[model samples]
Target: MSALTDNTYRLLRAQVTGATDRIVKLALFETVSEVCRLSLSIDPPTDPLSDFAGWLDDDQWLKNHTLVIAGTLARLYAMPKRPWSDIDTARVNKEQYDTLLSYARADAAEAPNIDPTARLLGSIRSRLPGAKDSQTRLALFDVLQEACQRGRIWTELVPFRLVPGKQVFSIAQPGARIVMLLNAQHSVLGMQALNYSDEKIAVRTDIATLNPADLLYLTMALAPSLGADMENPATWMPGDIFASKYTLLLHGVLGAMMLQTAKPYSNTALGQYHTQIYSRELNAAPLTDRDGGLPTRQRWRFPRFA
Candidate 1:
């Protein structure tokens, strides 16, 4: 490796390893918070599907995906880990497993390899948003059911597609370099679009200006390894969770890169001041207001693949 590249890799390894303790702690807190948020709404019997349906609108697709993601995350982070959980051992399709495994291998080495799983994931993700795909629909339902039992969130490996046209251009398979799109609000820029054509795999953004809530939300959404209470650790294992962790790290780096691209801000100051201000603003702001900020609370819209 070139001296520059080698130096950079060393730096990243140091950073990730150094923060492993923090990541584990932060992930635990996040998992608990999501559960608490859900608990506040759930009634006796705790029918998560019903609770989910009531909490969300008619957008079943997005609801299914989000619930599945949340559920899977919860399961992964569940305390006192359940080792024999079927959710963790349920056989993944051979082809799909192979594809993701290959991607994972590539990711470890930081190699650029084509990932078939990306195509499948993109297709499902696209369809899940609104397309009437029975498999996608059923899979999400199954995932939700799994979540109810084990608190696991199911995820698929997919390719980063071009926006507008939503065409699959390149896949950030395992080990492939990735870029982050969203700021703290999960407002993703068209990084996939830009990466499709160039060697670059990130976007330009004002991370220094990002609201802290947005960062927290982004952290929740981006960190794949982080989970809520869903199953026992022995059942799923740390290796199983690392993939998600890597993905989240990539997203975090993307956010950091965006800030770097903008006017340089000391990392220390960005974490302290900007994050605090953003957090206060987010906490103070209303999620929604009906009648154009009138007294009535506006209904919350669950975002689908849109």
Candidate 2:
């Protein structure tokens, strides 16, 4: 049952009928995987799913994740020069297929606030060589981490109190991760790390400096939300930073994918298509929510009561 049945091929073909042509099962099979990989690269799943061949035979995957199959059909039927190609009908299928992807992406927004790493990984794999290679995941992780760092603007109000007459005070969280202290007006506080090792810092209060009287809270340029291991698919995505902005990861990879010399996924268009989307999403995103998008302090201050 792990192979596409003749009935399945016929079912897929029914959507793109042609007098002079039919999609061979083998060809369709390959197309199914290509579409699946590309689709996943666009929006990664939090939990790992079956590979393309197994999913083709999986009743649940076919029934629930129909976009993968629909996308394949749309490509073959609409991509031009095929005997069975029909741009008009293919447009309809492609529209429906894209709509499904959109819906799934929207629904994913409601799921647990996980990292976009797993999703980004799938995306990187789809566009480049070494789809599941470890080195590739790490390299792409660096790409994702860089994006996260640049976009690392989130706040948390943890256990911190100004000790009067003291130049230094211990932070509720580590000093190395803290970006800066913020005043109540959300202005960066002129504070310096006295000792990152001790997680202590000093704040300057003067005519030219912001006041700690209404000291806002902690800001972090922390590492992505994920477990220690990069190899684990389960731990691939970090927390909220990516859940909603998962598409940003897609955009990032697409822009980067253009630079790749890899076939099939490569494009001569370079980063034009990808860059706009990446910047738009990254710039358009409001600073991550104070609580949800940032899980670092909570993990540190409130270790599992579980």
Candidate 3:
């Protein structure tokens, strides 16, 4: 099984056993909902393979089936909604890193052709004159790989937006919310870095210590805590309170799975989680009426100088 599969299974098992904290529980439930949606997409009427009950009770079944589940989660996690263009850039960064690494490891005659005009590669070439040395080249290759990994995580964590009148909810909404939960986990660990761009909100974190599976679980568990804050009628009214309650219950299970900490769950902690989540979710302008026609006015375009 892949490392992600193994880790995801373990974290899921922990969640099942009530071993995580409250914030994590919230996120886990949300992640599970996403997994269910993916499963439905695979086979809507009778997805026997995606049945949670079949794998939940039996440890062996859970282990055997996790690869598909984990892979789906990872793919969903990596996908970007409309209006978010950075995901493609991250993918390109990964491809470039892989290409550079292969070249660095290969003999000079075996090196692959790389476009000098590529933005990332151009920046590296300009800064490191001696990058031709095998060791230096290899080091540079590693740096790109690391940077790409970070970029991948960043793109995955941020949700894409659509122009007003395009869609009520961004296609990437669920994944973005899930990423918020993960960021909440990072905030607790003192590792989250969130920033806003003109197009979309972006997030970064020190996730080197987190396993893919652990990260997934953390994200899953954090969603509920965030929803609870968002559901407040004074701040943001919930469309369906019953559904929200059900979600909160699922998150409660996730919270139970967390390692016990000295600080108790209090209003302060709740506020902290809420603040972290809203910081990202509320950064963008409010969604305009979906039924409205697209505006005819053309926005100004800036020219780039070569």
Candidate 4:
């Protein structure tokens, strides 16, 4: 049994229209995951086996166990392959999940940072040789923003529950986290077709056919939070999205910096060369869409220049 499987509702498994023990456990796991992934602001947690603390112990988790149950049922009955498919009942469960998830999203900030992703990473700021003036400091922020906007240097996973019949979904986090939706995936279900604009995710499926707690995992190309003070390098951390992909972020920043027209670091030829390297490494990642066609994420690698 996984850490989440508890005797709390063992009897529920044997009742009318009962579910297997495995389905219950998976539902619990996904419920916990939805909250846990918010802090990441980057890639979704890669390993499922890793321990997630506060299991069954947290008050909110216990109180909202229905969110877990409701979400699961919505998935269960909505399946076309299942003999128990019940569209009407599924819609009711989905409505409950949607209302609950809205509350969940509202309180997302209070969710524990299992990996502490919101913490500052000084790696990028550390690259700039102690610039004395505010201008140089802000330049660092500007260039990073530009590089991120120019292409998908790295990707972030953001999961949100689907609201049935909602026409357009916004992934915009303006002034907070700069991100573009490179691709999207549906939990339980697979990759969803994404025709996005202004971070509005438009998928191919009919909304009524989907249920709430039906998670849509948006693979976003992210820029770290820009709300930090430009004058204070200590405050300039790049969020967890860049945690494992520091090289890609650095290359993008450096390339953009060198290409700046009037900056002290401007070196057109060198900038173009570094930019080329940035592009190469960006494409190498197995899951990132650096070129806007098909994103990969083989880990954007960087080579030291001679």
**TM-scores for all predictions:** 0.17, 0.43, 0.17, 0.38
Q: What is the lDDT of residue 261 in candidate 4?
A: 82
For candidate 2, write residues 173-214 as lDDT tens digits.
Answer: 432244333322235543332223334555554323444465
Encode model 1's per-residue lDDT on 1-306: one tens digit a residue. 132223322332342333343433343334323433443232322333232223322322121222223333333333233332334322322222333333333343432242423332333343223333343333323322322122222222233322333222333223222222121223454222222233223334434443333311210011122232233222222233323222322222222322332333224433333233223222322221011212232222113311
Candidate 3: lDDT of 71? 31
Per TM-score, what order, best first? 2, 4, 1, 3
lDDT of each: 0.29, 0.49, 0.29, 0.52
Model 1 RMSD in Å is 24.9
lDDT of 2 at 47: 21
Error of 1 at 158 (Å): 31
- Model 4, span 159-244: residue lDDT tens: 77777787578777544454544555665444434455554666667766877767876666666476766655444434444444
Where model 4 places Cα greater than 4 Å from the true spot, the runs are: 1-130, 174-179, 187-195, 202-205, 224-229, 232-237, 241-306
Tens digit per residue, CA lDDT, model 3, 140-235? 333222222221112222323223232222223432222222222332233234332232233344344333344221211111213433222222
Clash-forming residue pairs, model 2:
41-123, 44-119, 114-238, 115-237, 115-238, 117-237, 225-238
Candidate 3 matches the true fold with a TM-score of: 0.17
